[model samples]
Target: MNWKGVLDFLKEKKFGLDRKELVEAETSPVVPDDFCAEEVVYEMNDMGEREAIERFVPPTRSTATRKPPARTKGHSRGSMVDPRTNRAITFASAHEWRCALILLASPEIAEVYDQPPAITYVDAEGKKVKHTPDYLAVSRSGKKCAIAVKPSRRVEKSGIVDTLDRIKPILGDYADDIILLTELQLTHERATNAESALQAHSCRVQADCDRVAVIMSGINGEVNAYDVAKAFGDFPRGMNAIWCLVYDGIVKLANPALMLADHPFVFRVLQATSVAA
Candidate 1:
């Protein structure tokens, strides 16, 4: 064994020893403790800096100011299901409920919405104020209207009349018209009967309407309650169907002032020709 020759051969062969030493030297760099402390301070000062560089910074979703919701009148609120729209209509008081029923029954009315947009007006003190109307309605002729329900006494009291007078023109610009509907309009016995009739004869299907229309055409003119009921085979159903026609404008009552309880109630077909046409 030549020892000098053996050492030279091992060095020449390299034997993976030199490569392992080089890799260890490259991986383990000497880091200073003071430099590590300074890096920790930087990360503490700007915690989001790393996140900002590596990923997207989302926007802050916050409002500068908060507002409370508008308050409604403190009254005994009630709700009724409107047959025309089949929607639950809410009213602040009994007067409002009655007015809603009237609107539902009106042939002139096309649609009704509760708690319509707030109307802004300048008060008698020259201060700006907002008034939320009770009901907003569109007419058969495409006229927009705002209706305020109030008792007759309250209409004069609380300066309501004055306020409405001032707000009329303002509302008229946006609506076709604005009207104060007091108990005078809503509390009538005829109106009550009309509402009852509407409730009893709430018809939504075209088949019912077509059947009613045929009966009205056969009558060919104004007919008494008995005749109309008889034409439809005279039952609780026939009476309801007839009143439905009256409420829908397909038939017109001659004396709306008279209640349905009145004997020999008269009604004429308004849409007979139109239905034929």
Candidate 2:
């Protein structure tokens, strides 16, 4: 009944090694004096660090001037009221409009403004340049961002990258970051789904809050769209309510990478809020 001896014998026979060989193989290597931890260098009195910090930090001249770009006489322009901000947003191009729609439907975006201010910077040639970003956004996290929407073809020709780079230091004074978005990134199935969700935003009912809370509690964390629809007894109304909750940031799609059109859509409750609010 020596079970311990039996187990050790089996292990040694299976591995073809005794306890001495195992112990020797598991021993740690010795360290040399030359291999001691390098002394931590805290301060660098080099110009490299200074140059990098100066390049990234907002310039003092960023606040010296504020001027809007001259309006072109024949530029095609359109305007739409943002559902989230209730403000009339104007876009000079179709690309801009699509980008605006994407921003409007985003739950992360709290408020969006069109052409808030013109950023001024000096280019590589040392010429003073003024650039106006397409939109400025304030996120739910309170981070400020400036967005410029352009077609992929024009992104390089328009010097959008250089413009964003040169003006970033200046724009950093007002916004936490500057982003350049191409039409290719904004015009996608997700944008279409967001548009659909925005349309269903008005379907919220007073009882939706209680119903959603019950369904979420019942499922614990994740639930399929069909099951959620079944709980409400009316598929369209239930689906609309779910979309409304998503639009309001109450519930979030489990896989945002997948389009809402994907069958058996999965969702998770982000927060339980009174629909009456």
Candidate 3:
């Protein structure tokens, strides 16, 4: 045998023997009878029934009940994986995508479901209507909230507010509350911060969190996130730790504002559980 030729062929193909070796090895090899190739039936004398043969077939699978609507000429569509639940959520429009990220970034929110099951409710017109919310969020306290995302212009033009108003009354059946989010609430700063929180969550380290917790223990009053990050002496790791702390509820924004590192926040001293070993 050509040893060099065999090694060269193996390296080139990266799998199995070459044609020459395969032909040599299988030359006159005994072939087994096709015992189970065809479906077989067993005879039962007493039962008077033939035994059934089982065939391999993949079972049908389903997770999310509703899918995002198809994109029209003026609409947008996209998807993002929620880090909290490790589930992929599809958005039919940019507004819905923004809403998902904002919800995922909140410390109180535990899980987010996009295009949740439709709920039937009567509108002000006294007619039954089936309405599907953009997203449904579950809080840490186990409260569910149905969210509707729409542009301010469209909300006025299509009278979405009236529909939401009607849906709010019966929302207690499926959710604790119904919230209508508009572009005004989904600011650029919030979107940026939410994206940062998601990224920080992916690369979080326990050691860094412990260090940040120790630093926050010494804090009393409100402080800027940038200053907190500076206290750690390592900006990147410190900021990431701060975001992790925010998600854990140890750190909270002082008011309704952007969550950038430069923004003001107050440490939640009561919820300060040690993250150390």
* Winner by lDDT: 3
Please, what are the lDDT tens digits per residue for candidate 1 over residues 1-277? 4997676446534422233433443432223222221212223235456331233222232111222233466556666655545466677777777787778787777777788778889999999998777888887678998887888877767677787789887765568777888877787665676686566454333454467667767665556664555455433445566666667667766677656554335565544332110
Put down candidate 3 lDDT per residue, 171-248, tens digits, no spaces.
765999888899899876787777776667666776777888888878887766656666776656677788777666
Per the 3 Å backbone cut-off, how many clashing residue pairs does candidate 1 have? 0
RMSD of each: 35.2, 26.1, 18.0
Q: In candidate 1, list every pair of residues with a backbone clash.
A: none
On lDDT, the stronger of 1 and 2 is 2
In model 3, the Cα lDDT at residue 80 comes to 78
Between candidates 1 and 2, the TM-score winner: 2
Off by over 4 Å in 2: 1-77, 270-277
- Model 2 whole-model lDDT (C-alpha atoms): 0.64
TM-score of each prediction:
0.64, 0.66, 0.69
| Model 1 CA deviation exceeding 4 Å by range | 1-76, 203-209, 272-277
lDDT of 3 at 251: 76
Among all windows of 10 consecutive residues in model 1, the one with the lowest summed lDDT is: 32-41
**What is residue 30's positional error in candidate 2, in angstroms?**
78
